[model samples]
Target chain A: MTTMVLSGNEACVEGALRSGVRFFAGYPITPSSEIAEEMARRLPALGGKFIQMEDELASMAAVVGASLAGLKAMTATSGPGFSLMQENIGMAVMLEAPCVVVNVQRAGPSTGWATWPAQGDVMAARWGTHGDHPAIVLTPWSVKESFELTVRAVNLAERLRTPVILLSDAIIGRLREKVDLPPSVPVVDRPRPAMAPDHYRPYAGGPDGVPPMADFGTGYRWYATTTTHNERGYPVGVDAAAAEGLLKRLHSKIHDHQDEVVLTEGRWLEDSEVVVVAYGSVARSALAAVKQARSRGLKAGLLRLVTLWPFPSQLISQVAQRIRGLLVAEMNMGQMVEKVREASCGASEVWSVARFNGQYLMPEQILDKLEEVRRAWR
Target chain B: MALMRNRDMVERYFRRGALPTTWCPGCGLGTATGAMVRAIDQLGLDADKVVIVTGIGCSGQVYTLLNFDGFHGTHGRALAAATGIKFANPELTVIAPMGDGDCAAIGGNHFIQAARRNMDITAIIMANQAYGMTGGQYSPLTPMGSFTSTSPYGHIEPPFDMCALAIAAGATYVARGTVYHTQELVRLIARGIAHRGFSVIEVLAPCPVQFGRRNAMATPVDMFRQLQRATVSVREAELHPEAIGGRAVRGVLREVEGPEFTAEYEALIRRAKGDTHG
Candidate 1:
């Protein structure tokens, strides 16, 4: 194992490669383009493949296709590019293909701040792709964390047999940190269809809701489609029964064992009246603010949420019973704040320190909000 | 009697009960579909190893009409899906078949990208020159000054020279032919599928119902007759350059060497793993 300091972008490449990613397809988009550029340089050296797709749509599709062919595949993009990837993302989800998408989230409904850091896509990463389906989102707060979470993203994708989104805001994506680079990391590849060639069914799940996959030219009679279908992968023609079954399988596949899937960290909860909940880069600033408030004898604690989706609601609700005043700090106007609010019981006072002006949430900005909540109690 | 159902692969793999298509009598899609299936069978590619992706239109129904792994993608997205399928497994014989409107209009961006990437697949554009699926709207490839439901006063846009566009965009193998030229069409299609790089076959299949009425070619037979008179062999096509330029050229128009998107991409991936980036 070689311990070296690596930028978040470089670390992401390291993580993906270690996690068995053999195919990467992406177009150069600001902030996120480095991921592609590095992949363009590194994948080939590692005996992997990288493609500069014509655009984000094709980039995303190529990865999906590669993953189906039994390669660990991924693509990276920023805000505008991610928007272009929505339709194909839905297709990946519909087909339940195992792949990872690294969204080095930037600001805007359009090309707002191309190179600037913003955590605005926190919510979009979970819901950007149209249609109702299960979403797995992981948020990394630092360069080291970026390396770790990217591997987790691929593992979750294969474990869940679904498209996993590694939502790294531009701050974490561009920041540099030290990571332990092992010669190899444990990567969980999907189970190939162990069934014989003739009886192979494409969408048949093996009790745990994950259908064993088979690559093309592997002598398996495989079927895959974006349309609603049954175990055989043929379109079931929008029948109410078929829709219900499809939705049920999609829902159960993720929800049945939410415990293993959902993870959150608890901080300073045993003795505190005021609390702050944050994720991504904002969580870093919020941590500094929490320590400052503690020095001021303000009785404040910070809950650094590393996993952004499957929203730590129950644990949040449990934490709510102890803290009275809470502040949620995030880059967006109030994206994840709303989730924190919904999860917190009315016993606590919850307020958001929001930023939608294409900027990060400064420690002072969040500290100011904490002061307001404390003074109001007076 | 369907030309398509007669093909060996199409005959063996077709959903037996799904046959007897709704195509108008003498519809050219049947002929082109026949050529495509013959090409597939002649190569002896495995059904699962070849995925046929089709966009919304009469041609999309060909998904069910053949036995290979098929995807009936949204209108104009056949090439995009085929891009994914082919790149996913460079071994898969992926094909994107769509009508003129589906390929040259709604899906124009994807079409150009696929060609430019030379993404190791065959794109067969069934250029009937009209939006035959929804209504008789004029398509981008519809001959300029031609009549249609949307162009009752005749079309105002120049038809796309699909083969030329493909050649310029970077497809290594580019050809154009019509259903009337079945023998040549089949051979060309087979060659295109067997091509190691991206290939575009602009098939001038006729849409009898929608286009026949608009252009005063009342029957599929009339459409075929027009093709026979308007088209010339790729060899003879050079002799009558002016005549062929105004009509169809039934043969390979471009076959050049270039980097294939998949091989280059694979090479890049291997290089990125620390090999080299050329």
Candidate 2:
């Protein structure tokens, strides 16, 4: 173990290496470029490989390809690059390849503020790729959390046989912090098929929905495609029943395990009238506002979402039943707030505090929203 | 023909169940695939050690038909995928089988860069000069004044000379063969697979259903004979460059060893780790 000061992007690369990532294919994008640059510098020392792909599309395609070849692979990007990755991300979803994609988010619909922070990709990270497939997105509130979540993202991707998105922002990505990073963390490599090579069903798993994967050149000759396919991994073409079964399994594999996938942290929730829901760097501001409200003798609490996808809806719903009002604060105009409102199910009054002018939400702004909600109740 | 079908190479390499491929009858994809199989057989390469990557198109179906570790990726990204597969495990012989449009049009940048890196991967490009799977759309490889569905008034764009493009991009091995010359194609593909750096073998195969029916060459034999007549030897092409239009120069255009990307990457890792002996 060693203590060192590191930025979120640097921690991400270190955590990827500790998670046994041996292959990285990515295009350089601002705020996220540090992840690629660090990977290029450090991966070689560990005998891992780094490649600067031509674009995000190829970077994602290459990551999927490397994962299928039995390597833990990753790619980092932001904004426009993330948009370019949607098609191949769908491919990774359909093929059930275990890989991580890091989006060090910057402001934009199209290259908006390159060096600034934005939480605009919260919803986009889940539904960015066009399909009904499940997405796993993790938000790191601090630099240390960035390292932990990077490792968690890789493990979850390997365990579930799917792509995991480490949804970060420019603030956390560039923020430097001192913390203890272990020399090595526990790595969860995808299990290889133990079945006979000739008779193996590539998409058939054990009790879990994830199937054991075989690397290329491992004597397990099989096929993989992005099309809806059966257990055999060949294209199912127009087999409606097969497609239905495949899609159902893919969804259930994640949804059925939501207890394990969804992560959240609650502060002052035991007894509170108003609760603020926040994620990413905005969570820091949210905690401060909750403390300020408490100092002013107002019963306020905070609910921080560490995992953005699979929604952690059950926890939100449960908390909604206890609290009187909820305020959602984020860097975007309103993305995850809609999810917060839907999950609350009218049990509590839900409102959003948004900031999209290329700035993060401040604690004072969140405190103002909390005060407004309190006044409305009077 | 019966004896050849009974040979161990065919029985061992082809997955009989996956046979009767998705390709139409008289489609040159079948011949192109056969040549690739023959090439692997000639090299005595282990099937388990071969990873075939293909993109969306009629040519992309080759990976599915072969009994090897295969990846049928998204449209036009086969080479990009192959680059990762090769770099991840240099022990495996990575092969990307792509269509004219798959490699030259949508994936053009990846194609040029992959060659530029001199990565150790074999790329077999089936240059049918048109998008065969999508009802004969004109592609970047579609020759000037060629009529197709998208170019009903004849194409205005000039086609890419694939071998020349690869050669200029620093491919260590560059060659061209027509589907009509299956034996020669087999030899060229074998050489490509054996090359230590990036190798591209462009097979001028025919897309009878999409391309032939649109042009005057309606029959499979017409397309085959056209290839036979238009192909000139590399020596003949150099001696009489003027007569090379509307034709392909066959045989190995370039074969030279250089710093292969994966090997260089390994050496870099050794140096970074202070493994001076490596």
Question: lDDT of all predictions, in order shown?
Answer: 0.80, 0.90
Query: What fraction of the true interface contacts does model 2 reproduce?
Result: 0.86
lDDT of 1: 0.80
* Cα deviation of B201, candidate 1, in Å: 0.7
Query: Taking the tens digit of each residue's C-alpha lDDT, what string does model 2 give over B158-179?
Result: 9899999999999999999989
lDDT per residue (tens digit) for residues A1-378 in model 1: 889988888888889888888888888887888888888777666677777777787777777777776788899999998898887788788877788899898878788988777778877778887778888888888888788888988888887788888888778887887777777776888877777977777777668877788775565645567767777776676577877778788878887758767766656878889889988888889988888888887888888887777788887888888889778888877888778788886867788888877777899888888888889888
TM-score of each: 0.91, 0.98
- Candidate 2 has a DockQ of 0.84
Candidate 1 Cα outliers beyond 4 Å, as residue runs: A182-184, A345-347, B1-11, B15-27, B71-77, B84-88, B146-154, B214-219, B239-245, B259-278
Runs off by more than 4 Å, candidate 2: B1-7, B238-246
lDDT of 1 by residue, B1-278 (tens): 22334645545766555567767776788778878888887777777677777877777777766656666655566777677667667777788888888888888888888888777889999888888877879889888888899988888888888888888778899998888888888889988998888899989888778888778888878888998988888898677666666666778888887788778766655544555555
Report how far residue B79 has shifted in candidate 1, in Å. Answer: 3.7
> How far does residue B106 in candidate 2 sit from its true spot (Å)?
0.8
TM-score, chain B, each candidate = 0.92, 0.95
